[model samples]
Target: MVMLGDILAAARGSAGALERWLAHADPQLAQDTACAAKSVGLGIAGYARMAVADFSRFANEEDWATLVSSLRDSSDPGSTCLAAMVHWRLSAVGCRAHSIPQEAGAKDE
Candidate 1:
């Protein structure tokens, strides 16, 4: 059984990765990630600060959507990259937890 603590630890790791990615975000990668999400019908909103704790709740499709909406909507490249990273982590968590479907734009590339 997957422990909540393990999931949270992974989420925290993802957050750390986000910080690193933000420091040197690649425009091409960000653009590709956004396109991948859009191709799967996820709406991109505008930039808004995502709570650090949100990373710990990838237990459902709704949670995934919330993250995508907040992160992908950003006009800033760093935020876009962060969205991509968050999506990657959430997708992995969803697969491991079997909470989210594979068809929900979970593919990062």
Candidate 2:
């Protein structure tokens, strides 16, 4: 989930989504991380003010999008109240976690 957040941050850029997200935030919560600048000092001062847009700059945009997409697709989906579908499809004889013998799992992927 942390990675997912990071990927989302990168896709959102330094101003677009952060400003929009802040617009709907509780006033105190928004004020708490209110800084628009980057800080790299010691102690609590470093985090006294922060912004959401500053994150996920660590990864290349294209690669990040692909990675996030892959992770999202890997999870099979279903609504608990409905007839099961994706979960059963993934558990089919030749798919996903069933593709290999998990009992004797391979290491060093």
Candidate 3:
């Protein structure tokens, strides 16, 4: 099981490595890698937003779409839903800062 922070860190690191690899790749691979990196960064930022009670009030459909797109590409619906639920819960709490216990268990990456 991986905590959100750990997952975000791994994603960020992978994105960095992928970006470097993209610099020497074919056009298609470069595009794919860039997209992956962007997705990972988005996920990390989304998690941070949730942590800071900023994600719920930040109702940008475009951002949601971006997240959904990334989730689809990554084939990780559970992670997507977890991220979405984090924002949803924040919204439920009126975006107030509070401590929420981890539900069920840590997500597998």
Candidate 4:
């Protein structure tokens, strides 16, 4: 069975590769991978948000902003919520950044 980690890794990698390909004007691969990235990013962000929601101590405005920025920068889809949650957590903690690693093993996904 494929683990969530595996899925996220694949999505992130695909998104990165697609971005690079698009930069080079590789239309075929870029188009295909871009679509895939959006799906994967959304899945990952949603999972993360749901998993961390109850942990109010870690959700704040700064965290949300950072998360939103990351999500916007991400090639994934529907990541805006994830970003908002991050900001909320950070604001709650009165910190500009979270102790958690934003890049945590997952690359793009």
Candidate 5:
């Protein structure tokens, strides 16, 4: 069985690496984690989509912690599953910034 460390390592390497792990992992394990990730991802996506409509709501406190509490409190691979879920959610919502931050004195193009 894939350990939490394995999942975290893959996630740290790249989202693709995690995807590959999911793809090649045991069907039950992959399906369980993926399903959990998808549920969390879509919930987060709802919040993000809402925040896009109302920036103020961006700061809204959600019970997101509870959402992943199960994954976190689970046995081995629990945190790893949470990590993957978070990654998937962020990617799904385009939360990863591809551009570098500009310096204080940087001129705008």
Candidate 6:
């Protein structure tokens, strides 16, 4: 996993990789929001978030849309999820970001 190619292989495609990484990272983060918030900026999660953000150019409309919605979800401070979400937006800032005008699984408007 030292090479860029190795890292690329672990991520699969350009999307859904965050969930996979998180599964390996702190699977409990999804279940423990309080723990996640407290863990933010104090662990690899921060670097992981930054890594996700680095994928902006690789993100599709669907990817961007999910990221935005996740950011708005403050139900639990959005901790670990927020890390990846923020990165996704930042990475997209310089590019022609894509997104769904409607919610996920909703009919397109």
Q: Candidate 3 — what's its lDDT?
A: 0.44
Error of 6 at 8 (Å): 21
Error of 2 at 50 (Å): 7.7
TM-score, per-candidate, Cα-based:
0.28, 0.24, 0.26, 0.25, 0.30, 0.29
Model 1 over residues 9-92: C-alpha lDDT tens digits?
Answer: 443556444334433555454454445435544422211122223344443576657656765566653455344544554345
Q: Give the range where candidate 5 is weakest over 10 consecutive residues by summed lDDT.
A: 94-103
**lDDT, residue 19, candidate 5:** 55
Model 5, C-alpha of 29: deviation from truth (Å): 1.4
TM-score of 2: 0.24
lDDT digits (tens) for residues 1-109 of candidate 5: 5665555555655666655554564445455445544544533223223322332222223424543555566565544454444433333332224211122343435
Query: What's the CA error at residue 13 for candidate 6, in Å?
Result: 30
TM-score for candidate 4, please give it: 0.25
Candidate closer to the true structure by TM-score (higher is better), 3 or 5: 5
When sorted by TM-score, best at the front, the candidate numbers are 5, 6, 1, 3, 4, 2
Candidate 6 per-residue lDDT, tens place, 1-109, comes to 1333444444454425545555565566433422332344323334444445555456678876776676466443334344455345334433223331122243432
Question: What are the lDDT figures for the candidates, one per model?
Answer: 0.42, 0.30, 0.44, 0.41, 0.42, 0.44
Q: Model 1, residue 90: displacement in angstroms? A: 7.5
lDDT of each residue in 10-107, candidate 4, tens digit only: 44556453244233544543444334334445433333333345334544475556665766565642333333443343224333233332333534
List ranges where model 2 is wrong by over 4 Å: 1-7, 10-14, 35-109
Clashes of each: 1, 0, 0, 17, 0, 2
